[model samples]
Target: MTPLNRKKERLDGLAASTAAPAAGQAGGVDVMDPVDPVGEAGAVRDAEGVSLLASAWRRLRRNPMFIIGAVLVALFILVAVFAPLLAPHAPDDRPLIGQISASTNPIPKAQDGFPLGGDEKGRDLLSRLIYGSRQTLIVGVLATLGGLAGGVTLGTLAGAFGGWVDSVVMRVVDVLLSLPSILLAITIASLASQPSQWTVIVAIAIVQVPVFARLLRGSMLAQRSSDHVLAARSLGVKRSAIVFRHMLPNSLGPVFVQSTLALSVSIIEAAALSFLGLGNPDDSKAEWGQMLGAAQNLFDLYPHIAFWPAACIVVVSLGFTLMGESMREALDPKSRR
Candidate 1:
């Protein structure tokens, strides 16, 4: 045979041999079995179910800062939950009323019944401190939830439907962001004809709404242009699914971190409002901020009254801040190493 015919024959024989089924196979090839052209399909399938939050949690498990923060937050929550059980006396009870005379020190020193001593009003200082954690937690969590609801709604609407919708929402956000957080909170608190615990919560929530909305909006915008979003679009996935499933879920990492940080800020701001005489109207209620506010005049004479609450605030805030920062690091791909 000529060289060309010989080459063609060799090629044809090679193709026939390749097409032949193996000894164990029933057919030429398993047509039903899906092809994994790149050899990465198994790996992709294994990883596909893992979400960002799950991955972040995995990272957080090994993170020392996260552990410390989580422990502190847990203790704080536990103290708040068991305030009634933990506290030796009722928050409003004044058992040592007779001890507070012009001759005797208004604030009592550590004694048998009161471990942390007594406040000016003769209420158990330790009891109030424990109960104050509950009040503080309530304000922080509720305010954050309220703000989160409003912020998420505005952010989702702005991001999912850009153009004029984005413009109007952004304008409102801008107006809110323009004012300083404390100033804004003060203004909102002032607007309330009756200043109560709810007033403080609402004020803080309003201030935080803009912060969360802006953060979520920015994250959403970035997600909207991501490869997965583009792929979903090309695959003719519904826009709602893309926004809700792909974009919003992916964008919440930063928001969650911000929420953690915001809790600390809310507590501090609540204290500030109370200090400014805009907190709960009830003088007998046990709140950390209110306690701090009440101690202002007595701060110089008896530092422990102010010191205890302030220290609690600082420690608790530090815990939340640490947790938030760790979460941010965990969520950031660049910080993974």
Candidate 2:
């Protein structure tokens, strides 16, 4: 036989040998399982490399600023949750009407039962501070949540369904954004018969809606042209799934960070509205800004009344700001060391 024929026969024999079954086995070669590239990449990225949350936690733990911020935030929340237990008196508690109305300073002396001091109205300062946290927390948390939800919804829709949807949503966002945040909030608040707490919340949330919406929109747009999104489209994956699952999830980190930071702003905004005589002036509720507003006239003589509430607002806002900065640093790959 020619050399070429011999080579061909040898190849055929090798293939047949490989294909033939062993004594107890079916016909097949021993094929090793293929590695899942996607899963492997996730393992590498998630377990060891750049997990957003895990690495953020690691970095946060290592950060002294984050520690301080976390502690302060924890304490603030504790005060809010346990105002009754922690406070020495009821938020609306006052000294005897005779003695209180009978004083020149009108500031309850920080002695006997009262510890921190008293406001112009004779309500316990410490108690008010403690209870005010609950209101502040309510406004901060709820307004931020509302804004986050609204922004995410609008931004996702705009980003996913470009063209007219994008234009309409963006135009609305632009209109809201065009006005200053405080101005927008004040304008909306003015529509209310009085600055009820809910009105303040609604106004702040409305002001924040544009900010968060723009932020999430930018994030969504950035991710829309990413390789993974295009790949998912090419694979004929459901568009809704790709948008919600693939794109939106990846775009949430910045929005989350912004939400935290905006919460701080939200609290300040709430306080500002109350300070401006725009919120419910219920002394029992002990809102920070209202306390400040009430004390403005008495500020010359009794600064502590103003000082305590201002301090509460500052401390909470500072804590959130610090934590938000740390989160931003941790989540942004470019900022990671």
lDDT of 1 by residue, 203-316 (tens): 999999988998999999999899999999999999999999999998887888899999999999998898788999686779988898899898888999999999999999
* lDDT string, candidate 2, 32-97, tens digits: 223746435655433446556887898899999989888999999998999889888788877533
- At residue 72, candidate 2 shows an lDDT of 90
What are the lDDT scores of the predictions, listed in order? 0.90, 0.85
Candidate 1 ranges beyond 4 A from true positions: 1-51
Q: Listing every candidate in turn, what is its Cα RMSD in Å to the true structure after a full C-alpha superposition?
A: 8.0, 10.2
Which candidate should be chosen as best, given lDDT against the real structure?
1
Candidate 2's C-alpha runs over 4 A off are 1-50, 101-103
User: What's model 1's lDDT at 181?
Assistant: 96
Model 1 RMSD, rounded to 1 decimal: 8.0
lDDT of 2: 0.85
Tell me each candidate's TM-score. 0.83, 0.83
